[model samples]
Each structure stands twice: as structure tokens, then as C-alpha cells.
Target: MSQLANDSRVQVRKKSKERSKFFWGMVYLAPALILMSVFIFYPVLKTIYYSFYYTNNRGIPVTFAGLDNFINLFTSESFLISMRGTFLYVLYTVPLGVVIALFLAVISSEKIRAIGIFRVIFSSTMGVSVAAGSMMFLFLFHPTIGFLNHIIGLVGISPIHWLTDPKWALISIAATSIWMGIGFNYIILLSGLQNIPEDMYEAAKIDGAGYFTRLFKITIPLVSPTLFFVIIVTVIHSFQSFGQIDILTQGGPAESTNLIVYSIYQNAFIHTKYGLASAQAIILFVIILIITIIQFKVGEKKVHYQ
Candidate 1:
């Protein structure tokens, strides 16, 4: 009876300690929880609530909309255009930006003379704000007196309408986004490359492996983790591209560059279709979530951690 009582008391004490630890943990987490509740959770819940209802011009929910908002979004020509444009934009930006950045990373990792100068030059675009970069590219893409047009003109070609033409407008925006993103990508990839041990390369050389062989076998596999991170970030960034689109094209030359986020902005703020905008926002969230899940499931298999 005495031993049983002692064991029971010990169990109680353990439970008490656990409860105390849990209480302190909650205390420590209170600020973050409160901020997340107010900022992230509340907004997300509000957006989801708004998505299923019709809203007045003042942004108050007026009536239950059921699936009407999503139905209209799928059927609407403008929304479809925005969807297509966004996907195309993602496709154009993610691959090319990563490739260019990777190439720059590889070259800049070399121990050549004045490589620091080259590194600075290569990664300089990261310092430019999106709006500023867009404005700079705006001048560059101008048909009348642009540097690009001037170069083409010297080569006996007529000046092409870069921003005005529907065919080239998206491409031009993709180019600008790629350039703006390269500095960040380059830095990340360079850091990844620098993390690789030089001894691995030396061993490969001793084993009669050529430069390309070592690069393919050693450099790329080690860098896969960084490359994966860059790809994910770039995809998300491309999907959410807004500043450059707003500054450069305003989703125009007939809504050719009407990305989903900008489309959401247009519907919500500009047109006062709050419910529709909320629905679009939800769709964007779902799309991103699905893509991220898919990437982790499929891509993480190839990520090698050293």
C-alpha cells in the first residue's frame, strides 16, 4: 500500500511538471500566436468567408453566393486569360531564371583574376528595387529610342514594339523578371557551390575524371539542394509577380499580362468585386499549396544533404 501510494504521487508529480512546462511554453508562444491570429489567421478566414458570398461595393458580404464566384471565375474570359498568362509567365521565368543564375554561379565560382568584380557585376541586379528595375527596362523596351531598338536598327532590323505588341509584351516582362531575380539566385547558388569540398574535385581529377565529368557527377548533385530551393522560390515569385507588371505593362496591351494576383487586385480594389476577388485569392492559395506539395513529394527525392 505504501509503495503504490508513492508511485501514484510520483505520477502526479510528473503530470504536474508536464502541465507546468506546457503552461510556460504557451506563455512563450503567446505573442507569436496572437500576431498570427490577428494578421494571418484572421485575414485568411475572412477571405475564405468572403469567397463564398456576394459582397456590396463597401466590401460587406450581402448574400450567400454558393459556388457562383468560382463558377464565374472559371467561365469568365478575363479570368481564363489571367490564368493562362500566369502559367505561361511561371513557365517562362522559373526555368530560364534558374538556368541563367546557375550558369553565372558556375562561372563566378572560378578562381580567375578579378572574379570579385565579375561577381559584383553579375549579382548587381538584386540591389535594384522591382519598380526601379521595371522603369529601367521600360526605357530599354521603348520602340522609339531604346538601346535594344538601337542595336537592332544598327543590324538593319526595324524597331520592334516590345511592350506594345501582345506577342512580345509577356516575353519582355519575363526577361525583366529574370534579370531582376538573377542577383538573388546567383548569390544563393554561389554560396551552395562554395559549400562543396574542394577535395572532391581533386579526387575526381586524380581518378582521371574530366572537367565535365566532375561537374556532372560532383558539382551538380551537391548543388541540387540549393537549386531546389531556388526553383521553389522562383516559382512562387513568378506566380506572385506584380510590381514589375504594374509598373511596366499595367496588365495590358489588352490584358496580355494580367497575372492572377493583379487580376485579384483589379477585381477587389479597382472593380469593387470583393467576393470574386476573394475567390480568386483562395484559388491562388490552393494552386500554390498544391504545387508546393507536389514539389516536396517529387523533388525532395533528388535533394542530397551533405
Candidate 2:
């Protein structure tokens, strides 16, 4: 009887200690939970709720809209154009940005004097804010006094209307995006390159492997994980791009550059169509989620983790 009581007492004490630890853990987690609940979870739930109703200018849902908002969005020509532009922007920005950054990273990773200076210069754009970069590009794209036009004129080519022409507006913004994105991608790829074991390259050299052969077989496979991460993040950033387009074109030139996010912004703020905007937001969220999931599914096969 005494041993049984002692064992029971010990078990009770262990349970009490677990309960005490759990209580303190909750106490420590309270602030983060509260912040996420208020800022992230609540807003997401509210957006999903608002998406299925007609909202006033104040964003209060006044009537049940069912699937009408989504239906209308699919059938609307402007929304279709915005969708096309968004995908095209994604296609334009992601591959070029990744390739250029990877090339810079590879070249800058060379063991030479002043390589750190080159790295700093390459990644300097990471310090520039989006607003500032957009403004700089805005000046560069200006028709009359722009440096770009001046250079073209020196070559006896006609000065181009970069942001004003429908054909060039999206491409111009895409170029600005690629330039601005290079700093971040370069930094990341450089880090990945530096993380690669030098011994691997030494072994490849001993095998009489040429530079291009070793690069294709070793460097790419080793950096595949980082490359995959950069691609995913760049795609997401491309989809959510807005500030540059807003400053450079304002969805003008016949709405050729009216991306999905900008279209949502116009609906919510400019047109006082909160419900439609929320619906668009939800669609964007779904699209991003689907794309991310697909990337994880398909791209993970190629990611080599060491």
C-alpha cells in the first residue's frame, strides 16, 4: 500500500509540473498569439467574409452577393486583361532576374582582389526603397530629357516613349523590376555560392572536368535549393508588384500595364467597390497558394540539399 501511494504521488507531481510548464509556455506565447490573431488571422477571415457580400464605401457588407462578384470578375474584360498582364509581368521578371543574379554571383564569387567591392556594388540596390527606385526609373524613362533617350538619339535612333507607349510600358516596368530585384537575388545566390564546398570543385578539376562541365554538373546541382527558393520568392514578388506601376504608368497607355493587384487597389479605393476588391484579393490569395503548392510539389524534386 505504501509503495503504491508513493508511485501515485510521484505521478501526480509529474503531472503538476507539466501543467505548470504548459501555463508558463502559454504566458510566453500570449503576445505573439494576440498580434497574429488581430493582424493576420482576423484580417484574413474578414476579407473572406467581405468577399461574399456587397460592401459600402466604408467597407461594411450591406447585402449578400453570393458568387456574383467572382462570376463578374471572370466575365469582365478589364479583369481578364489585368490577369494577362500580371502573368506576362511574372514571366518577364522572374527568369531574367534569376539568371542575371546567378551570373553576377558566379562572377563575383571569384577569388580575386576587390571582389568584396564588386559584391557590394552588385547588391547596393537592395538598400534602395521601392519608391526611390521607381522614381529613378521614372526619370530614366522620361521621353525628352531621359538619359536612355539621349543615348538612343546619339546612335541616330528615334527617342522612344518608354512609359507612355502601350507596347513599351509593361516592358519598361519589367526592366525596372528586374534591375531592382537583382540586388536581393544576387545577395542570396552569392551566399549560396559561398556555402558550396571548395573541395568539390577541386575534385572535379582532378577528374579533368572542364569549367563549363563542372559548373553544369556540380555548381548548379549544389545551388539548386537556393535557386528554387529565389525563384518562388521572385514569382510571388512579381505577382504582388504595384508601386512601380503606380508611379510609372498608373495603369495607363490603354490599361496595358494594369496588373491584378493594381486593379484590386483601384476597385477598393478609387471606385469604392470593396466587395469586388475583396473577391479579387481572395482570388489572388488562391492563385498564390496554388502556385506555391505546385512549386513545392514539382520543384522540390530538383532541390539538392546537402
Candidate 3:
């Protein structure tokens, strides 16, 4: 009876210690939880609430609008145009950026002398801020004083109004996005490429495989996981692009470059339609969620391991 009592006392002490640890752990995490609740959770919930109501300029709810906000969003031609432009930007930028980055990464992975210099040159754009890149591109693409026009003029080509012309404004912005995105994708793919087993390539070469065969059969499949991740993130970023458009075009050139994020910002802040902006934001959330889901589903089948 005495031994059993002693064992029970030890077990109780152990359980008490665990409980104490758990309580303190919560205490340590309380600040982060509080911060998230105030900043992230509260804003998300408030945005959802605002989406269902008419709101004043100060964001105070005035009247219940039911599905009116969502309906209006779909019916609004500007919003539809913005959505189409955003999708176009994604379609234009993502694949080109991924392909360029992967190509650079593969080249950088070679055993060439002074390869580090080339790697740095390729990835230096990663450090360029969005505003800086936009400004640089803006100057370069300026029809009159721009270096691009000057260079092309030497080849007997006419000057193109990159930002002012509706035909080229969105495409020009996409080019800028792709240029900035390339560095990031290159870094990720380079890291992935570096991790690939050298033995795999050696074995393939031993089997009399050519360069293209080795690249297609081995390198691409091995680096596919990183490529998949880059594609998803690139799509998301392209969808949410705002800084470059704001700095360069302000969604002008006849609203040709007015992407969804710019539209949301315009509606929320400039137009003082918080409810409508929130509704647009929610729709964007849904679109991103669906795209991400599709990516994951498709990636599971495509992402090759080892």
C-alpha cells in the first residue's frame, strides 16, 4: 500500500509539472496571439462583415446590402475589365518568368569559370525594390527620351509609347513584372538545381544521353518541385501587383492596365467605397484559393521526387 501511494504521488507530480509547463507556454505565446487577433483576425472578420453591408466613408456600416455588392462587382464593367487585365498579367508574366529563371538557373549551375559573377548578375534584380524597378522601366520605355526607343531607332524601328498606348501599357507592365520576378525564381531554382545529385547526370551521360535528353529527362524532373512552387507564388504575386501600376500607369492608358488589386485600392481609398472594396477583396481571396487548390492537386501528380 505504501509503495503504491508513493508511485501515485510521483505520477501526480509529473502531471502537475506538465500542466505547469503548458500554462507557461501559453503565457509566453499570449503576446503573439493577442497581436494576431488584433491585426490579422480582426481585420479579416471586419472585412467580411463590411462586404455584406453598405458603409460610410469612415467604414461604419449603414445598411445591409445582401448580395448586392457581389452582384455589382460582377456587373461593373470596370471591375470585369480589371479582372481580365489581372488574369492577362498573370498569364503573360508567370510562364515567361519561370522559363527564364529556370534557364538562368541551369546555366548558372554549370561548372564554368567565374560562374559566381554571372549568378550575381542574374540575381541582382532581386534586390531592386518595386518602386525602383518601376521607375527604371518607366524611364526606359519612355517614347521620346527613353533609351529603349533610342536603341530601337538605330535599327530603323519607330518609337513606341509604352505606357500611354493602350495596346502596350498592360504588356509593358507585364514585361516589368517578369523582369523583376526572374531574379527571385532564378534564386529558388538555382538552389534546387544545386541540390540535384551529380551522380544522376553522370549516370545519364554514361548511358550516352545527349545534352537535351539529360536536361529534359533528368534536370527538369528533379527540379520540378521548386518550379511548381515558383509558378504558384508567381501567379499569386502577379494577381496582387499594384506598386508598379500605381507608379507607372495609375491604371490609365484608358484603364487598360487597371488590374484587380489597383481597382480594389481605387474603390476602397480613392472612391471611398469600403464595402465594395471589401467585396472585391473577398472575391480575390476566393480566386486565389481556387487557383492554389488547383495547383496543389495538379502538382501532386506532376512534382517528381528523387
Candidate 4:
């Protein structure tokens, strides 16, 4: 009877221990879970709800308008322009960022001396905030007092309006975005490059393969997984670009540089058209989701884990 009683006590103790562990685990995760629910999930659902209601003057009425907000978004010209500019921005930024990052990664992975210093210099831009970097680039390309204009003057060329000119404004913004993004992508790609085995390169060299040939055939394929990640992230960032447009151009010069996110901000906060803005935001979200899904679907087929 004593032995049986002891076995029951042991089972009770084991159950109590498990309960304690489970309780502590819940305690540890509670704060993060609550935050996610409050901020992320709640806001998303609230936005969708708000998208169906219209507000008039005096801020009192919020009548349900069903799909009117969505229909308005489809018919809006400003939204269309913003979407076009956003598409162009991403089209340029993603490919440029990936290529430049890969180039920097390859250079940094070389056997040359001072690689650490180069890495630090390249990655330092990542520490700078987007607004600050945009402002700095704005000054650098400023038409009259800008350093770049001075260099052009020395070469007997006229100073080009970097921010004010509609033709060059988006291009300038894209260049700055590429410069700012290169550092982070370089670090990621460099880490991936470091993980590659040196034996593969050695074997390629023994087979009389030159540097460029081996790089094309082996290095690129091996690093494709990292490249795919960089491409997706860069594309997303480009789609969400607003700060550069806000600070550098303010969507001026005929709204040539206004992106979708900036236009949404203008509608919600600036224009006080909450319902319409919410609909626009939902559309943007759906577009991003579709693009990201497509990227993963296509990338998985091309990515080589080995």
C-alpha cells in the first residue's frame, strides 16, 4: 500500500511540474501575444471595418457605403499615378539593389587587405535613418550650391536640377535608395558567401576554369538563395517608399515622384477621407501580398539550398 501511495505521489509531482512549466511559458509569451493582437491584428480588422463607412463634415456621421470606397479608388487618377510611380520605383530599386549588393559582397569576400574597413564603410549607411539620408542626398544634388553641380561646372557642363526637375527627381531618389539599401543586402549576402565551401572553387580552378567562368557557373548559383531573399525584401521596401518622397520632393514637380504609400497618407491624414484611404490601404495590402506570394513561388524554383 505504501509503494502504491508513493507512486501516486510521484505522478502528482510530475503533473504539478508540467503545470508549472506550462504556466511560466504562458506568462513569458503573454506580453508579446497581447502586443501583436492589439497592434497588428486589431488595426488590420479595424481598417477593414472603417473602409466601408463614410464620414461627413462635423465628424459625426459614419454611414455604411458598401463597395463605393473601392469603386472610387479604381476610378481615382491620383491613385493610378501613385501606383505607376510606385511600380517604376520598385522595378528599378529591386534589381539595382540586388546587383550592387552582390557586387559589393563579391568584392568584400576577396582576399584583398582592408576588407574589414570596406565592410564597415559600406554598412555604415544602414545606420543612418531614411529621412536623414534623403536630406543629405538632397543637398548633394542641389542644383546651385551642390557639390555635384560644382564638379559638373568644372567640366564646363550646366548644373542640373536634381530635386526640382521632374525628369531626374525619381531617378535621383532611386539612386539614393539603392545607396542606402546596398549596405544591408551586402552584409546578408556576405554572410551567405562566407558559408560556401572553398573546395568548390578549388575544384573549378583545377579544371582550368577562369575566375569569371567559375563566378558565373558556381558562385552565382550557390549564392542564389541569399540573392532571392534580398530581391524580395528590396522589392517590398521600394513599394513602401514614402519618406524620400516626403522630404526630398514632397511629391512636387507634377507629382512625378509620389508613390502609393504617400498617396494613401495624403488621403487619410491630409485629405481626411478616412473611408477612401482605408480602402486604398486594403488594396495596397492585397497587392503586396500577391506580389510576395508570387516571389516566393518563383524564387523557390530557382533557389539552390546546397
Candidate 5:
């Protein structure tokens, strides 16, 4: 009877101690949990709820609209045009951005003198804010007084209206995006390149593999994971491009540069179509989620881990 009582008491104390630790652990996490609830969870839930209803300028749902919001979002010509423009922007930025960044990273990874200077030159754009970068590009691409045009004029090429013309506006924005994005990609890929084993390249060279052969068979496979990450992030960034398009083009000259993100901004803030904007926002989320999922699935197969 005495032994049984002692064992039971010890078990009870152990349980109590565990409960105390768990309570304090939750206490420690309370601040982060609160922040996530307030900023992330609550907003997401509210946006999803508002997506199916009619909301006024104040963002309060005024009427139950059912699937009407989503239906209208799909059928809207402006939405379709924005989606096409976003697709073009992605095409113009992601692949080329990755390739350019990788090439710079590879060149910088060499043991040649003054390579760090070149790396700094390439990565310096990372410090520039989107607003500032867009402004700089806008000035450079200005038709008459711009240095870009001045240089081209020296070669006898006619000056072109960059942002004002529909043909050139989207391409010009894409160029700015690539310029801004390369710095980040280059830094990441350079770190990945530095992490690669030098002996692997030496072995390839000993096997009589030339520069291109070693690059394809050895460097590419080893750096693929980093390359894949850069591609994914660049694609996401390309999709979210807004500041430059807004500052430079304002989605104008026939709405040629109006990306989906800018279109969402127009609907929600500019036009006061809150519910419709929420629906579009949800659709945009779904599109990004789907694309990211596809990238992981396909990219996993190609990426070689060492």
C-alpha cells in the first residue's frame, strides 16, 4: 500500500511538471502567435470572406454576391489583358535574369585579379529601392534628353519614345526589372558557386573535358539547386512587379504594361471595387501557388544534389 502510494505521487508530480513546461512554452510563443494572427491569419480569412461578397469603398461586405465576384473577375477584359502582360513580363525577366546572373557569378568566381570589383559593380543594384531604380531607368530611357538616346544617336539610330510608346513600354519595364533582379540572383548564385568543391573541376579537367564540357557536365549540375531557387524567386518577383510599372507607365499607352498586381491595386484602391479586388487577389494567389507547386515538382527532377 505504501509503495503504491509513493509511485502514484511521483507520477502525478511528473505530469504536473510537464504541464507547467508546456504552459510556459506557450507563453513564450504568445507574441509571435498574436502577430501572425493579427497580420497574416486574420487578413487572409477576411480577404477570403470578402471575396464572395459585395464590398464598398470601406471594405465592408455590403451584400452576399455568391460566385458573381469570381465570375466577373474571369470575364473582365482588363483582367485578361493584365494577365497577358504579366505573362510577358515573366517571360522577359525570369529566364534571362537567371542566365545573366549565373554568367556574372561564374565570371566573378574566377581567380583573376580585380574580380571583386566587378562583383561589386554587378551587385550594387541590390541597394537601390524599386522606386529609385524605376526613376533612374525612366530618366535614362527618356527620349530626347536621355543618355541612352544620345549614345544611340551617335550610331545614327533614331531616338525612340521608351515609356510613352506601347511597343516599348513593357519591354523597358522588363529591362529595369532584370537590372534590379540580377544583383540578388548574382549574390545567391555566387555563394553557391563558392561552395562547390574545387577538386571536382580539377578531376573534370584531368579527364580532358574542355571548358564548355566541364561547365555543362559538372558546374551546371552542381549549381542547379541554386539556379532553381533563383528562377523560382525571380518568377515570383516578376509576378509581383508593381512599383516600376506604376511609376513609369501607369499601365498606359493602351494598358500594355498593366500587370496583374497593378490591376489589383487599381480595382481595390483606385476604383473602390473592394470585393472584386479581393476575388482577383485570391485568384492571383491561386495562380502563384499553382506555379510554385509546378516548379517544385518539375525542378526537383532536374536539380542535382551533391
Candidate 6:
């Protein structure tokens, strides 16, 4: 009977200790929770609230504008052009980024010497600032004096106005974006490639699978999770592309390359149409959210975590 009583006391003590530990854990996490609520959650709610109101030259006039701003945005020709440009930007950037990154990852994963040095060389571009990189590309693609045009001259072709010509301006920006982004994606895919088991490749080789077959049938499937992650992130970043457009094109040659985010910036800061800008921002947020959710739904089926 005494032993039974002692065991019950020990159980009670353990339960008390567990409760104490949980209490302390909550205490440790409180600061982070508070910070997130203040910085992230509050800003989101405030932005949504501000989207419904109109602001004038004096200040923000807290009167609801209903769907007027949204209606105006959709009806505007510039908005339409911006939307088209933004879509083109995302479409080209995401797939190209993924494919190039995957290719580089495969090459880097090979049994080659100085792998670390090669890795650094490939990823070095990621460290360059967006504005600086865009400006560099601008000079490199200059019509007559550009290095690229000089090379093309040897091939019996005239200089291309990469940035000044409307048709070529968007393409130029896309190329610069790809060059700047490929390095980061390559590093991500390289990490994923390294995590894949060597034995799997050996097994495939023993089964008479060629390199391309193994890559398509085995490597791709195993790395699908990482690939999906990279795609989603790349898509989001592409949608938010502003620095390149601002520095290189400035929505130039006829606002041909004006993207949605840049348009919002112009409306808000340049035009001082805060309410209109907020509405545009809200629309952008919704579009991104819907697209991201769709991607998650579609990609979840294909991702092979194992």
C-alpha cells in the first residue's frame, strides 16, 4: 500500500513538471508571437482596410469608395498593359529559371574536381544587387556601343536596340532577370541533388538506364518537391519584379514593359492616388494568393517527398 502511494506521488510530480515546462516554453515563444502579430498580421489588416478608402492631397480621407477603384483599374489601358507584361514576365521567368537551375545542378553534381570553386562561380551572381545588375545589363545591351551588339556585328547583323525598342525591351529585361536569378535557383537545386541517394543512381545504371533516362525517370521524380518549391518562389518573385524594370526600362519606349507592381508604385507615390494604389495592391494580393493556392493544389499531387 505504501509503495502504491509513492508511485502515485511520483506520477503527480511528473505531471506538474510537464506543466511547468510547457508554461516556460510559451513564455519563450511569446516575444516572437507578439512581433509577428505587430509586424505581419497588423500590416495585412491595415492594408486591406486602407484599400477600401480614398485619400486626397490633404491626407487619407476615411470614406469608403466601394468597388470604384477596382473598376477604374480594370478599365484603365495602362493597367491592362501592366497586367500583360507582368504575366509575360512570370511565365518566362519561372520555367526558364527552373530548367536552367536543374541543368546546372545536374552538371555540378557530376564527379568533377574543384566542385566547390565551380559552385561559387555559378552562385556568385546572386550576391549582385538588382539595380546594379540591371544597369550592367543595360550597358551590355546598348545599341551601337554594346558588347552584345558588337558580337552580333561579326555575324552580319545590325545592332539591336535592346532597351530602347519596345519589342525588345521586355525581352532584354527578362534576360537580365534570368541571369540574376539562375544562380540562386541553381544553389537550391544543387542542394536538393546532393541530398538524393547515390545508391538509387547506381541501381538505375545497373538496370541499363542511360544518363538522360535516369535523369528524366529518377532524378526528376525524386527532386520534384524541391523543384515545386523553387517554382512557387520564383513565380512570386517574378510577380514582384520592380527594380529591374525601374532601373533598365522605367516602363519605357511607350510603357511597354510597365509591370503591375511598378504601376502601383507610380499611382501611390508618383500620382499620390493612395486609395487607387491600395486597391490595385489589394487586387494584386488576391491574384497572387489565388495563383499560389492553385499551384499548391496542383503541385501537391506531383511532389514526391520520399
TM-score of every candidate: 0.96, 0.96, 0.93, 0.90, 0.93, 0.91
Candidate 5's error at 231, in angstroms?
1.3
**Per-model CA lDDT versus the true structure:** 0.96, 0.95, 0.94, 0.87, 0.92, 0.89
Question: Candidate 1: deviation at residue 78, Å?
Answer: 0.9
- Model 2 spans > 4 angstroms off: 1-3
Model 2 score (lDDT): 0.95
Ten-residue region with minimum lDDT total, candidate 5: 52-61
Instruction: Decide which is better by TM-score, 1 or 3.
Output: 1
What's the TM for model 5?
0.93
- Writing each residue's lDDT as its tens digit, candidate 1 over 1-306 gives 999999999999999999999999999999999999999999999999999999999999999999999999999999999999999999999999999999999989989999999999999999999989999999999999899999999989999999999999999999999999999999999999999999999999999999889888999999999999999999998999999999989999899999999999999999999999999999999999999999999999999987
Sorted on lDDT, best first, the list reads 1, 2, 3, 5, 6, 4
Check candidate 3 and list the clashing pairs.
none
Considering summed lDDT, which 10 consecutive residues are worst modelled in model 6? Answer: 53-62
Clash pairs, model 1 backbone? none
Residue 237 in candidate 5 has what lDDT? 86
- Total clashing residue pairs per candidate? 0, 0, 0, 0, 0, 0
Whose lDDT is higher: candidate 1's or candidate 3's?
1
CA lDDT of 290 in candidate 3? 97
Worst 10 residues of 1 by lDDT: 244-253
* Native-structure RMSD, model 6: 2.8
Per-residue alpha-carbon lDDT of candidate 4 for residues 179-262, written as tens digits (9 for 90 to 100): 888889989999889888999999999999999998899888999998888888888888888888898888877888888888
Compared with the true structure, what per-residue lDDT tens digits does model 2 show for residues 1-306? 999999999999999999999999999999999999999999899989989999888989999999999999999999999999999999999999999999999999889999999999999999998899999999999999999999999999999999999999999999999999999999999999999999999999999999999889999999999999999999999999999999999997899999999999999999999999999999999999999999999999988997
